[model samples]
Target chain A: AQTVTQSQPEMSVQEAETVTLSCTYDTSESDYYLFWYKQPPSRQMILVIRQEAYKQQNATENRFSVNFQKAAKSFSLKISDSQLGDAAMYFCASSAYSGAGSYQLTFGKGTKLSVIP
Target chain B: DAGVTQSPTHLIKTRGQQVTLRCSPKSGHDTVSWYQQALGQGPQFIFQYYEEEERQRGNFPDRFSGHQFPNYSSELNVNALLLGDSALYLCASSSHMRLDQETQYFGPGTRLLVL
Candidate 1:
């Protein structure tokens, strides 16, 4: 069984500032994927960024990036130059390929981010 | 292209009643996955469907069942619902043949409220 943990229940950042949401996980699979999804009030789970476990370089998508320390099992999301729209619930998830197409995502409890303008 | 879609955006039900939620995958996507997001918690995987068959499932019980169609669309059915079933039901879609199969796009989700 794979477990993902998000330590911060809630976090706040000022407009134009940066924020980092923490995440950790435990997985026995040799090959896997990690992801960060953002859900706003619209109730849609939007894919923010992703990191392949085999990659040593971190994943960066514009203002969104991830600090993935595979050995430590830590995958944190960083939002740079945060805007009001960045305020949302962020979730870190892991999916291991357990053969025969087992790519189910194990997610953390999520961190509610608030951006103050 | 239209992203993933779900029907009956919101629903209200009572305990013991059964409910079904619908989902349509994104264009070109051939796989669909269901997840349940409880209040203030992350979404938990319920199951995944591909080739009109259930390929993977989470820790959910048998009461939570699903069906996939030839068009890559899907439906989630929960029988003998309890108040604990109240939560946002999200449908995600991906492609099994793609190199980046790890990426799954999600729908707006169907919010179910069980009283």
Candidate 2:
């Protein structure tokens, strides 16, 4: 079974500053996917970004980016210019690349990020 | 296009009771997956339904069962609920397209409180 680990249990960043959340995973499959999801107070889970194991370049979306070190099995999410709206729980997930019915996403414990004004 | 939706938004039940949760997939989607998110924890895969059949399931027990209607809507039923079953239940939907990658849009979860 594949397992994802989030080293940071709780993190806080000042408004307009930058913060990075660490995540690591263990998977024997060569072809897989890594994802970052955010859950706010509303309880809705939103996708932040994703990275393919076969891709060398990291994935970036707006102020959100990922440092994907495939060799080290590390997939960290960096939130730049953090705002109060960025305060939420971040989760890292891993899944296989099977074409159909591959909806199972093994998730990490989660890192609660707080944005301080 | 409406996104995935789930209901009832909140539920409270006692131990040894049965509870039913519903989910409506986004338009044009054929697959729906369910997840359980305990407080202060990440979401865990419960099971997935595609083509009106259970395609895959996670480490959950038989106490958790689900059904998929012909319209692609889904229902998650938990029988003999336990206190540990108290958590946020999420439903997600995704279309079966080759180039679409694996983009699973999620619904605002239903909060289940098992007393």
Best by TM-score: 1
- Model 2 per-residue lDDT tens digits across residues A1-117: 789999999999999999999999998888788999998899988989988888999999999999999989999999999999999999899987544546468899999999999
TM-scores for all candidates: the values are: 0.98, 0.95
Off by over 4 Å in 1: none
Q: Residue A30's C-alpha lDDT in candidate 1?
A: 78
Query: Each predicted model: what fraction of the native A–B Cα contacts (within 8 Å) does it retain?
Result: 0.81, 0.65
DockQ (Cα-based) for each candidate: 0.83, 0.67
Candidate 2 similarity to native, TM-score: 0.95
Q: B-chain TM-score, every candidate?
A: 0.99, 0.97
- How many residue pairs clash (N, CA or C atoms closer than 3 angstroms) in each of the candidate models, in the order given? 0, 0
lDDT of 1 at B19: 100
Tell me the lDDT of model 2 at B111.
Answer: 98
Best-fitting candidate, measured by DockQ?
A: 1
Give the per-residue lDDT digits (tens) of candidate 2, residues B4-105: 999999999999999999999988888899999998888889999988888888889999999999999999999999999999999999877644446677
